[model samples]
Target: MPYFKPFKMIILGFDGVLGSVLSGALDLFSFTGVSWQRFSNESVEPRFNVQIASLGGGDIRCSNRLIMQAHCDIRDVTECDLLLVPTIGDSIDKVLKQNSELLPHLVRLANTKADIASNCSGAFFLAKAGLLDHKIATTHWAMPISLRQIFHWWTYKKISL
Candidate 1:
């Protein structure tokens, strides 16, 4: 059999993140090529090397007050196949204000071969990074107006949760 390297997946971790969205994203990607193989009694060849990356490689305090540990520092991540930004559960303004440091990294990674994705209000990070400029983007249906108001340069498609 030919050797296969796992795809690197980095999930951005920060305070004010939604607990469910963060854990759900982690579970979904981490189990991609491993779980079903186990259930079918096949060889387990995991597909992704998933990691939760925070600003300082420290603990993350979710909006729900759950504390979670990050796998690495976001500043140290030079490359990845995919970078996920989970839903922001707290006040979007407050969260953005507190995690401003992530913007530059987002822009840097966006320039790489990484596919950047976000859930709900997390798209604000991508927008703030100037990635969505003149590009089509979307968010939770209820937030289209809010996002549009803040990011008038991009076109938004409303998606219902």
Candidate 2:
């Protein structure tokens, strides 16, 4: 069998983060190669090295009151293949304010070769970090206010997929 290097994936965890979204993203990435291999009766080899990170490697108090432990401190994470910002379950403004310290780390990661993505309203974080500047962005349809309206420097477009 050929050796495979697992893709490094980091999921940002924070207070007011949607519990379901956070866990779902972790499960989806973690089970990618293992699930298919198990069903195929092959050796189970996971494809991603997934970890949940918070500012200080502390426990995350989710919006629905679900508590999640972090795998590592966001500050200690210097590299990754992919970084995912999950949907915010609470008020966007509040979440942003509470997690303001993350913006610089987001910018630093964005400057790396890592692929950055967001689910639903998670785009707000990317936008707030100035990572979405000059890049077309979209958010959850239920988001009443547009990303462009909030971040004047962001280039947002409605995407149907």
Candidate 3:
């Protein structure tokens, strides 16, 4: 294996985002080394440095009324190897408008060429930030029509089994 530093992942936690999604990403990434040892009988150092953040930090109230505590604000994040944008609830348009505060920070991070991933409604954030321009992106099934209507630069391909 190549010598490497831990990958820094800054997960953006926002108001009205699904609390489960944030926790799911955290739990999955936080214990990668432990999981490997447990399942593979080999010990290795953890590879990811994960931080859950918001626009201004503090409490992030979700659409389901679940409040998650963020470690810091996006402004405090100086370097990011990966940035995961969690989804807001049903109204991607409303959430995008209300959370415009995160745009500048996101744009700066994108300019750094960090890998950015968005979940469901979070794709709208990427689109609005122009991060998804000329990039392929997929959103929740219920919202793909709207996503396509608003952000035509990205090609969304639907697959059926």
Candidate 4:
């Protein structure tokens, strides 16, 4: 008898804000019985073996009241099998204009064979990273024009809640 290793789903956390939403979506789909892993800077009380990436200093306050002490950097995300990017309440204009700090890392990760998922405005991060070029993607309908204008090569589908 042979044993198979469990498939790991890595959720990228900037400040541990979208952890709940990403986790909840995964749960909703029952996605392959995935083991949700977070790549965060903060040291969270171990819920399920989260990998700390050492981002130097930052406060982590999730939307669902899960707080973490910052600990890791984006460079440490190489080992993740899958990547999930969730929305953050920051100035999208600035992030999109400046290409955001995490843009490069997300681009690099997307080049790999790993499955990538983004929720809400997280899709903006992916678009800025150039991952959505020639790909079909959906996002909250409110930003359709802006999104299409920014990433003209993509086919955008407006999603309504």
lDDT winner, 3 or 4: 3
Off by over 4 Å in 2: 158-161
Stretches off by above 4 angstroms in model 4 are 1-3, 15-58, 61-67, 95-99, 152-161
lDDT of 2 at 100: 98
Model 2, C-alpha of 69: deviation from truth (Å)? 0.2
Q: Per-residue lDDT for 10-116 in model 2, tens only?
A: 99999999999999999999999798899999998889999999999999999999999999999999999999999999999999999999999999999899999
In model 3, the clashing pairs are none
Residue-by-residue lDDT tens digits, candidate 1, 10-76: 9999999999999999999899968888999988887889999999999999999999999999999
TM-score of each: 0.93, 0.92, 0.87, 0.63
The C-alpha lDDT values of all candidates are: 0.90, 0.91, 0.84, 0.60
TM-score of 3: 0.87
Alpha-carbon shift of residue 17 in model 3 (angstroms): 0.4
Question: Who is ahead in TM-score, 2 or 4?
Answer: 2
Q: Candidate 3's residue-wise lDDT over 117-156, tens digit each?
A: 9988788898899888787778888887888788766566
